[model samples]
Target: MIQNQHLFHIPVMGTGHSIDTPIRIAHLGINSVVSVVDDMLCEKIRQHYSSVHNIAYQNIPKSAADGRAERITAYLNLMADIVGQKFDELKKMSLLEGTEKDRYFRLLPESNPLRKSYDKIASLTNQAVRQNLIKEITGKMTLGSIDVNIMAKVDALKMGDDGQPLSSEYSDASSALRGYANSKLSSSLVLSAGFNPRLYSYLSEFKDFYRDKTGDIKKKIILKVSDFRSALIQGKFLAKKGLEVAEFRIESGLNCGGHAFASDGYLLPVLLNEFREKRNQLKETFQPMIQSFYESQGWEYPELSEEETTPKITVQGGIGNNGEMRRLLEEYGMDATGWGSPFLLVPEATCVDELTSKVLANAAEKDLYLSNVSPLGVPFNNVRGTGSEKYTRELVEKGKPGSKCPKGFLVSNTEFTEEPICTASAEYQLLKINSIQESDISDEEKENQKNRVMDKTCLCTNLGTGSMIRLGIMKPSYGRQAICPGPNIAWFNREYSLDEMVDHIYGRRESLVPKERPHMFAKELTMYVDYINELAILADPEDAEWKKLLRMKKNLDAGMELCMEIAKGSSYEGENLHSLQSTVEEQKLRLAEIFNLVPSEA
Candidate 1:
């Protein structure tokens, strides 16, 4: 049902980096996600692109009712228009060398029948037959989905100026969903960062989410999950309301960019294996519930085939090369692979400014680490030497810390004030720091705690600053950009063209990473090892902590065993399969050190 010529998609980066990715590359038949978390960012991008495309633009002011949803809808509609125009033009272009049509087919996977057909047709000796076949092939061409993402947890309740909470419909996540639902774009809405009950319930209100009379879903749902159990749980909940999840996008908990949702030590390969084994259970469990809901509503449930009703299973997070991607498709049975962090370097695809782009390009493995910079209290993947890091530290040195809290999207704390405030806000930090100094604790411990408190940066605004800077909407001096790139970013040390990156994905080009780069599974194993090692060091696991740590240890051990089996099996080139064995053996030693420090569970 979710058919596309290409095998890979660009996952949502930060709130800003891939905000306008569809406008840039959807015409090329490559799917990409836009984060609708910050509607102001959407409005700004919409305004900028509207000018660039010479389209009439209208500003949706903040005071306007349903402004957030309006902003998102307007931006998405504009993108739909622009991408539609470009794709139509590309389809009409001649199949000459270096033309868009040539690039479009050339970018398809080697196994794609259309690409193979294009190659064979291009070699036809007869002009008339070739021309007719070309028309047929071009007619079959489809546009890449202009998908959007909603971080379900960022659904903060909005308040009116009269000091009363707005209706649940006006919440952050609800507004975003409303925006996408109201849009004219026929694409999927990816819900990431765990599930929200209210947001999930709101999906039932949109008629487009349901199967039409012709058994077509005008707009689909893609749940970005971390494990098989999560996929089953979330998928069933949506299905109970007659909402079908078109795809289950599995992302590595720790190996991904943005907020790292570390699982209970379940590694990527182990998770994938579970999904592979139990992928059928997802549809089997959801189908009946969906049918029941439709029947209760007195709506006809289309007699769709099983394949059409089945949810797609795709994987992302730290997918570095073609070999890993192929294994995910052939070995583990994924629908498609999502290449995320690598696209940060592809300017034609992502919107990263020059200053932040340089930092991402030259960053080494050591420079990229899991940081505590996110106000959501989640571990964020961060790089060193960014304008944001420098600015936050400088403010601390100057006796001023935290952001101005211009955008309160991440606000969830209400420790001192009646109204909630962001942890990265200046007022909250000042109050927290004063409270910490007044507490009865060791000087050294207080300093450490204060440093952690000061580390919370303005991700709500700063994440979008790079896009603003890149678009020339904001000056460099005003751009305190905060970028989140996964550890896989270290292997790529320079900018890449869209053609080069797409070619690399299909194995038409040579490996972009170093030969020493670890396999995605092996790399994920090391990160989990480091995570537990740090936890084992910090955790005073006298009772409950010991049990949690022990449970995590068991999961890690099981994952390592699976990795060993995979390493011993047949491998594709550039998979770095050997790294799995070595990494497992090496990490076993580290695990031993951690357990040595941690006492056995009672």
Candidate 2:
């Protein structure tokens, strides 16, 4: 496998957290991904990057959308303008002369007192001039070669305005793939939100871009999976459609920020090892199936190169230090590791309100917890004490259950209306609260229901407006900011520059030196234990809860066994290892206590 020079990737944060993310990363000549959920912000960043830096910046923007031709078309049109505007600026810069040209070429010495200030200004001027010169000399402006990969979440694909599945012509995934097909600025389509056969079939229509002249795939498709089974299943499904995934991005369930999709109990280290061992077998099994599919469709089965068929394995979640980062890459053969929450501290790469960033920097372990704040019903990583959370509670105390719901992105509930409504909407929450009060249940249940209703925040606007509030650009009435940072943020106590973060990733420097931090495996186990306790509380005295508990116990047992194996084989012999062993033993005791509560199978 070809190891990337930029071995790290910045995964998609919320619409607000990663606003202008790519532009900042590109300024340092690094590869980065941007969230395109907020298309207007994406367009603005694209325009600014192209105009300021004459070189075509390669960025990946993730789209979580319903299949709308108009929506996809708007993004493409904006992209076209972004590219056109960049070249126009480059053309103007090509004609620079005198002091302007001199300043562009001149490199200020580090010893100069004003070097830092001058270098910042001159870097932009120098880069633009240099790019213009390269274009002039080569007589080739490869505008189309600009990288702009689009990420589409399969499960989140929106239906048409008529409340039907989008037609093939207007299908979101297909349109995005076809829109950029064969164009110089063509972007790869990354399929996320797990596997969907219909989405794969729709993409097969553009076989030309999906597969190259040599039968090798030209366009890249990345699948975000939580476990080996999901990866294998998705890989086989794609191969059956005569397609091969370029990468399998494995994310941790509870350790990540935003939507926390906790696994039944599958831990990260075990999942990685499984993938490492089965990767070759997986590729070998899928290749012929893909070839057979092509043959069945009366198409010539393209012989794929070794690299073309083999998908790179990548992991993200709770990766706090260079030691863990290096181990994942070197030990598991992972191609890339993602850093998301840490970048929130680096204002250069991610958007965070100054107040929110401070809150995150000063946050302790208890401050960051998984909560039912998302309107989507998914458990979201949330900060306990933020302006947004405080505002949400204040409104609840005042008998107002929900926010204004200005941008109705998460409005997909039909609980009270003929048309869909957001659960966090004032209309819906007010209705829900009244119903819960009248329900034939215990007072405890009523209180629990009320708390859940009040917990729902307007994540759509709250997530996007934090940076605007931090920059003193826009201030919403409900709150100034909301931040979603993973548990790992607690270990990193200070803000860092992008360079400092990169240095930490590459082991050049240690930016995060916490007094006490649990091993990643131990941390994951602890999360699972906490989750089990919560489940136990809500669990009924029935077969269903028993079955769930049994499954969880099985997974926990497997995870603990793996932890022991790691401890036995690991070279490190120190306090860290002792802490890991202690944590594992503690989890074992907790698991046993839960297991004892379960009724006997006999």
Candidate 3:
């Protein structure tokens, strides 16, 4: 009887492929299918659930003498009903959690019995795609070069505002991760590649293009515990992933770090338990790696802090039956951890609801043009708002070499590059700029009013309002298609967006786009640099104190950048690592010159 309740659900890719013309096929219909499924479950629950131990049990148990029997019966019924209904859900969720992909499970609709069961679900998802609920990708690699581009875009927006670059391309839009798209809409981001550093190497490409195009480089941090034997490793990994996501929030950037892992104790507990005699010897091997992230204040000096909320590990029960799994992840503490796949499986059941709909909406928006090209979907950095990337800025500069830029396009690299959105943005002239004053007209009283009719500008306050419709739900809508039109083709080659393609080809990314607020970032930075330069002129070049401060800033940037570059760089091996050190050293000297902090002794 319970077996008959078993229902299979087919998952469909949202990368839209044009069946004929504009009504591109896709996944926005997922909600309807889910609702249908939910309805069936509700009916089943009502029909099969015993009044004894279900929620019904609570009320009856108080009156019933032999409540135990009622509880047991209800519990059994609940378990059976859940098991049958959850078969596909659990299966999908499990696959999402692991690094492995069976492909067969992902393609359940192609078969007979499984296909029949999932037909309705599959058709709905397919309808969403066919309707262009999915956005498109350009197949552009975005990992390698990111920061420079983000920075460039940021700079371009300001310079354009101040007539530094093309005066027409000035957008003062700012964006935040887990935020809405309209207020501070963006089209790209640069960030740490993700947790599986050993697998992907695409960050450099993003870095170069993004910086060159002026996209934001979302920064991420990692803390890992290296003890392996105690099985605490999973916690460490989860911690790193969790913390990395937190760091993105901490830095006012779009949350993109989903791969940072904790490995601090990955090797310690294992060695301590298994090779007690050689524990000291093993330290020799891992110590160098750990010690390099030097903390003058202590082990928790900078990014490696035990003060953070450790990743709540769920895998220990099923990820690993042993006790030592989480301990191993803790050994190598990582701030940035993974959450994308987990969220994808049961977005409704996840604790990370803030960025879920934003990312999905963004992904759906970008999937339009990419449908003819891939199945991995596309990246949502644009709508998510590309972050503080050096290269992203460079890229923007490259695009709008004239000097002044536009306003709405500030946080977006797509406007400056070969993107899919066909928006005809007109740079406003002499924008009447002033923060909303709360004392007189705009206050708590106007909260709802402002959100209702307020023009979508580049302010965090306003953007949140705009995203109200887009967040928390992953279905694609008109907003998603603002940037790219999916395929003009089919599901086999369709990639809704670049981010999706990256995910499909590489995996969940670790990098995130930081916040983009409608403000003068480049102008502000330039002002600060000018003030420092003026101070440098006043102070003697050989002044030791000034040199120290400059050196200090350099050290800070070096450390921050190193973490970023290491996290950002595609190739973390040999010459690249050595080259990173040298690059930082060189930048340190440049900082000294900028601040007039040259070596006094010399």
Judging by TM-score against the true structure, name the best candidate. Answer: 1
Which 10 successive residues of model 3 have the least lDDT summed? 17-26
Whole-model alpha-carbon lDDT for candidate 3: 0.24
Predictions in order: lDDT: 0.91, 0.67, 0.24
lDDT winner, 1 or 2: 1
Spell out the clash pairs found in candidate 2. Answer: 66-158, 144-184, 144-185
In the order shown, what is each candidate's alpha-carbon RMSD? 1.7, 7.7, 22.7
TM-score of 3: 0.25
What is the per-residue lDDT of model 3 for residues 1-602, given as tens digits with 9 covering 90 to 100?
Answer: 01101111111111110000000101111100011101112222223333322434233232343222233233323433433343333333322233111222232223224333333343454655523311111111011100101111122122322435432222221111111111121122212212332111222122211111121213222212222232233223323322221112111011121111122111121222333333333233333433342232143323333433122111110010011222223322322122222122222321122333343344432332111111011122222231212222343345421112222332333433443211222121112111223336646645543322122222211112112223322222212121111111111222133223223222233312212211111111222233344446557757885675465454345343433344244431111233334444454455556654565511
Candidate 1 vs candidate 3, lDDT winner = 1
Which residue runs of candidate 2 sit more than 4 Å off their true CA positions? 1-3, 27-29, 40-188, 207-209, 214-218, 295-304, 470-480, 571-575, 597-602
Per-candidate total of colliding backbone pairs = 0, 3, 221
What is candidate 2's lDDT per residue for 1-602, written digit by digit as tens?
11233567777777667655543443222444544454444444444445554646443334334323333344444544554564444434532243322222222223322333333443455777656554443232222222333434422334565677655644444555555443333334555554657666666776543555565555566777898888888888778877777788898988887788888888888888899988897788788887788788787766666876777888888887766776787788998888889888988778787778889899999998988988888888887788888888888888877978775666778888976788889999989989999999999999999899888988777777786665455654536477788898887777887667776766565446563677777777888888888888778758597688778778877888888777666632121455567888888878777766432311
lDDT digits (tens) for residues 1-602 of candidate 1 = 33567888999999999998988888888998999999999999999999999999999999988999999999999999999999999998988467988888888887888888889986899999988988988988888898999999998899998989999999999999999999998999999998898899998898999999999998999999988888888988888899999999999999998999999999988888899999889888999999999999999998888889899999989989888889999999999999999999999999999999999999999999999999999999999999899889989999999989987899999999988899999999999999999999999999999999999999998899999999999999985899999999999999999999988888888989988899999989999989888777778878787788889989998999999999999998788999989999888888878787432321
TM-score of 1: 0.98
In model 1, the runs with Cα more than 4 Å from the true position are 597-602
